[model samples]
Target: MSDEERFVYDGAHVVDPLGDLEEEGEKSAKHNRAKVGSARPSSLLYTYGPGAIMDLPQFTIMPTGLDEWDRIWRRRGPTPPRIHAPRLRDVVRMTLRSPDVQLCPYPWQPKKHSRSPEGNDLGVPSRVFPQWLRCTGCDMLGLLSQFDYRNTHPYRTDLAVFEHAKCTGRAGSGTRKATRRTAIPARYLLACPDGHLDEFPYDLWVHRGQPCAKAELPALKMADRLAGKGASAVIQCASCDMRRPMNEAQGEAGKAKLPQCRGRHPHLDAFEPKGCPNATRLMLVGASNLWFPATYSIIVMPDSPEEKASDLADRVRTALGDKLAKYRDNLDLVRDLLGMGHVDVTELPDHDLELLLQAASVSPDTPAEQEQKLRDWDPVDLLVPEWQHLVRPIVGNRAEEPKSGLTLATRELGPGLRPEITRVLAVERLRKVNALVGFTRIDDMDRVGDLPRRLAPLTRTSRPAWTVATEDRGEGIFLQLDENAVAAWEKRVLDTDVWHSHEEAHRRNFERRFSETAEQVNHKTRLKPPRYWLVHTFAHILIREFALTCGYSAASLSERLYAWPAEGREPSAGLLICTTASDSDGTLGGLVQLSEPSRLQPVVTNALRKAARCSSDPICAMRTPQDPEDFLHGAACHCCVMASETSCERANRFLDRRFLIDLPGSGLGFFRPHG
Candidate 1:
């Protein structure tokens, strides 16, 4: 996908401020900002949340932090709909310790169209990022204010861009024929591990932090010594005749030359009050590690699964009673009438229309207060409730408890199936909720356990009451590993050197980064069991196979793992492979159909057989976590195991193909090498 196209859902275009609002079906949109591009509300929580740099085709913008957004929302006539994700809300509230925490989609402008300009403000308020800009035609460097702004199209906002009105081919030193050229953000940026970001000090760097004759208005020229090579560039000042290679301001020398961190958060337009003590590190813009969001997600579950007789059947009957009058007797024909929009209850075996017809019409609806309490939890283990609902079907008095966002069925572990996998669940229809708590820059907060130390707040100092999130609809397949096999394998591997080596590698890798505050969080990376690596690796393997045979790229599908051991609970080893999208109200049945016994059996066997030996075998299969320099993963490489960074949890770390198959020939493979 094109860079701009990848962030938001497909078909969403840049909001043109000059367009006919009524003609396009939008009653109102921003007329002032003339935003050259637009992002969907879901994208706000993922790639472009508040305090993230949104590099669009026309402009490099940062979603203004919560500080400025609060004022704009105060006048709110028509605001974004508030989403209810009780499972996710419970976790986020527990994490942030703010009981009033709410989850909301990104706000939209007033939904009223009129001649008055009282409220024409468009999507989330944003500001131009990287105040500095460079003229491509001439090497002259200056702030963005010096460039001329232009919106080429009346309604196509993506065409709006910054341009150097006049260009002297000779670095602005000559008065020759001048032509307009698009301006780009200066290549370099400064940031620290603690999440402080600032523009490269171009003026101070060329002069070595000393003022030149033209210090007030320096004529800085950034000349390239080599194309696509940052260090080869040279920054020169025309006034003082001072020049320095860009390499001098990088690596070890950079710490001495670059100023101490100002604790600035450009997205918030404020410097942190705590005042960072560490030296800022030099970085190039568009680097992958620039922003990393720490999000909490959960599958939407029947709201009252945990309670004894949640009365959810009555609640769903009440909810459906109003809408069911027309299709009362002929539920079989409901699917044809709804045209794939509605999930018919008859599709699930346990909840057929006949059963619903035999029960009472509708009892008193469950109280909203009591209904919410079932979704609430003091304990923060988010996976238990979901596991119970997925493994054991939740049944009500007459018919199964129903949720509009979920339709599920189980293809139980029956005769003549693979011994390793004991249960398979076909989640024909599912909804997932995601919430953004905080983000980090420069380095990733790989495991959720590291969140406390690594998370960067949205604002400079203040804590916001609510978080931005999105609810997605899709389908998936859930598989549970055999408990006996998993327990026996853990026992067999517990004393082996291979398991100890992998465990030690995790400790060393995690300690290498946060030795100063290792005790802050639980240190999940240091304590992951062998079962985690086994299940996580299998997910990667199966998804890669799914990509080749099922026509879905591994990147498009994501995995939700359930491996942590909670007190007084049975051994947990289950993973869900799902494809979710906000635009697709619900997905086609292709993914769910693949979960059928006839199809999935061969796919599982094929994925394992292929992973038994990588094309890069010997070099790939023989490798272990010990040989690498503190890097995690064993007997796994890009060719065989590594998945897309977006899909794999832990950013593809802690994976070991050797556990799944005996590539090393030491009798460690759980599948018995060639079984």
Candidate 2:
């Protein structure tokens, strides 16, 4: 979906410059107000939760009060609560199984109560965080800590901030006073690279963290200069007669000037007893780098009976409901034993519990037979098993029956593209589950493999045991490339001097961004093989082509690569370009229609033809990876082979059109015309 369609307008965006209007003009004002309120649909409450900063038309808001989940649930007024206790419990179980992951549950405010006869209990919550607001009318910057729960209405916590103080900016009639004004979230926050977030230390910044003999309640003000830059912004302490520029609290030098992290988790209303040693940096609350969610995903394979076993477990859980909670301690043990073999009623020690366990382990094949069936599973790569399942011919097996979630069919390719392309699968329906394991700040996703200390939890409880997750459904086009053809092309490319230059440029870029230590540098030195480059470049071209023909936008479509190293047990190369949405049913059959042989042939031909010559012409085609303007890509740009960051799995890096089509200065094109 387009961002415009998803972006919502909070009521604060529609401010009336003119004060209170006359009685005759009130109708128009009311109509405008209603329109803005409707924009923030209740459905958003299901998608966003605390710590998640939602983009408003004017500013942003982080949904606070996740720590107050119990409080919110008790006071949930007329509108029924959206409860997912079962799903939440399941997610917690999954987190415990994955040792590398930490648990942090996203706030889920269901639209309606599960017990409600009219409501369905399958909805997920929105992940929007609340903000520390600053009132424009009285120029009062209020901290989230100052919010009084006594002022909270039964159902609406949003109104608590307005009750703090009435606006003093405008005059009132007789003994009356100015009306209440809404406050927007503060724009600035203090954070460390270790993912410790806290309120901007206005007092410590101005006082320089020294003991000041000033008034008990000192006044603090944030003034903006005409320059409209961080350097021009200043924070002042009236009592101490002190002031400091925001610029000094930014960048590398700012680390020395700022205070140490206090280890505050505002979203969960908690703090670390042991203070963090890392120095804090001034960061904009809405900065994209502040939150980088690390997610792990796997394609659902048909040949894998574990998929069916999982479904059966879910069915048993649903049937037992509250009764299943009692068996939580033995759930894993029961599941493991069930996977190995069926338990005989006569050999079972506990007769009463046998039925429940048997129901959960209802499978057609016996343990030994299932093991023998999987003996031929010689997967070439991590994704090879999934690719094999996609290409497999589906017949009359109940386990392999076409489900509503994912449906696939293979097709034959024409002679021209056949030598390079091995197989094509049209996916009619597919479901993707993205689990939020942990997050990092300042650092990129490359550091996900590091220790848990380097990552931040989604919730406040130290050493949490569960994390939140969401599922998306969609359609896709899958293609497999010939391993031999890819191997031959890779050998030719690696021998060329141009390939060596590309490798050196990649090395320089890596060292520049990361530490120079041998350990860090060596970890990233596994140079991307020519085969990866060839497949990655082709994926970009295909995505660009699919975006124009398919109804979905380029950003909505994402790529999944299946490639192997130079020396590996299995030699495999393939790509899956798919798009998914938060909605129940994924998308139209546009992508599936394009999977047809007649339709796919033209798309490939046009994409390759366009890649042969970019709009930038000889300059773009002749550019090398060593060029200062082009550090990662060669003979490629936005107008040619580059794609949106959301679409490319490699962050739009390690791509070169020369690998796909012949270029002016290089003869390393893998897809050059045979004639």
Candidate 3:
């Protein structure tokens, strides 16, 4: 039910409150003639949320909805506004991943509501944070805090560069004054690993945090040198006659030279009263490490009929009369809203209502029992139930077949492969809902749960109760491997000195990246087991082969590894390689077609053959676990087993083609000549 407004842009021009324009003079004559309106699925806002600076045709903008709360609460009169939780159904179907987290909808002023004639009619508003802007004509610098503007309108369309009257730079003729062009956002910002973001300390940067009494206000200018490197770029302040190079704000030495973090959250229009001790690092606006979304997902599975009580409860609710049916799903909430005296349960038959209430309660077990149930669940436990649902003998509801979100088919494998290969399941359809729980800046995604609390809130005064999410429909191929064969091969690999050395190399690589001490590395880093390595490597090799015939780019395809190597438990080995898109129709059936026996046999053989030798062969095959350049991968490179990071789950690490195929001096391949 959440929605937001976004400016639409055609191939030729962009139209908005900011002066309409084409691609920098390509179609200038038709710029002002283009139409503008809000577009559906407004994915731009979802892709680039708060803290991201977007380059619009006229001006650079940073979308921020933090101050909208003050405007909204005032319109609600003297009483406090209520922030209702999203319906329970929405939690299960859409925002289930981050059940505890929620975000408020961006304020908007819609013209009309189709469902309710007299209800509130306001479209979602677009909020922006005016940070630093640079004038195009004079190339002079300015800060948003220096501007004086009115806030009566829902949108700010009057942003311009007029305060700097001293700027004498001209456009064409010396006699006429130059009209300054739209301002561009500053390219650099300061951030900490703990997700704190602030405008770059331009004044302190140029002066090295030294006191300046000569001038209260300084004029800053950006100068580009012939080298064009960031280090060569310089910022000069005219008031005190001081200039500093951009090089003093980058890399390890730059990080050390910078000031401590001030704990600024520009998106929320707030700052921590007490400063943070974490060292702030200078990062470009477009740096990849700025935002890393933390997400979790589970494969759809069937369960025992006893566990299917929710479905029965849904049927019972439908059978009940309209008055009772309305509140049947959320009886607790309705009961709280209307006192026991108002809710007349005596009207319903006592015995039937009791049974209905029992069925409505999804779990009769205690909290301890529920926790144990989830803890004992494994890959096999989840997958077997799904497999059972797929291989049912008969199709009951003919009308429901087309509407069902999932379509799956399974078959036994043919000869010419190792005995470890068990069954293959081709998933023709799948619906995956990925909810954005929270994001981290300049840090590995390990401690995502401990993110800053103010980042994802349902309201200004309350904690988050829901999160934004998107659903992706897709197709995939699943392969189940023989657990016994996997365990035996894993045992052989574990016994080898090479494998032991690789484990050490992995530990070293993690320590170097996260700056973790030796003792911390063991507990913090989740080391990939040998079985996981083999399955992950095989998935990558197959994905590479599938990309050629599946008519999908390798980057569009992603792999999901299902492996459990817990001691005293039966191990499970499976891989699901799928292509997903934000669109509703999912994808073409090329992947499912490739999963057929005739097509699959050759694909598997060709993939194994390709992995047997790399273009960088003898050198690649001979590479040791402790190679200076790559400590995580072995006998793998772009030319062979390595796949795009988007396609691989483990960031393209822990992969060794040697684990999947025969390599020189490596006789421990799981699928090598078994005779």
Q: Which candidate number would show the highest lDDT if scored against the true structure?
A: 1
**Model 1 per-residue lDDT tens digits across residues 1-675:** 222321122223222222433343464443333445677656777778876788888568878766455545554643334576766775675565544466876655433443445435545767777878877888778898799887645456777788889886774457678799888777788988877789988898888877887657878888874766766778888877889888887778667888898877777666555578978888877777788888888887877744312232332343354555656566665434433433334344435444554342544324454335433432326778788778774353112335647777767554435788888888888888888888888876653335454577764333356677777888888899887788788778778887777777777776777676567644553567888888889999988887776666688889988875544675588899998886557777777777878888877888998888888988888776673357778788899988997689777887888788777566677766433
State the lDDT at 437 in candidate 1. 80
User: 333-427, model 2: which lDDT tens digit per residue?
Assistant: 54444444332223345543455555554443444554454442222333566666665666632122354256777666865553577788887
Count of clashes, each model: 3, 21, 11
Per-candidate Cα lDDT values, in order, are: 0.70, 0.58, 0.58
Residue 272 in model 3: lDDT: 52
Q: Which residue pairs clash within candidate 1?
A: 14-38, 36-157, 36-158
- Model 2's TM-score against the true structure: 0.72
TM-scores of all predicted structures: 0.80, 0.72, 0.72
TM-score winner? 1
**Model 2 segments more than 4 A misplaced:** 1-50, 56-132, 145-164, 170-179, 211-213, 225-228, 306-382, 393-404, 415-419, 447-451, 460-465, 512-521, 524-526, 617-619, 627-630
Q: lDDT (0-100) at residue 417 of candidate 1?
A: 51
Backbone-clash count (model 1): 3
Candidate 1 global TM-score = 0.80
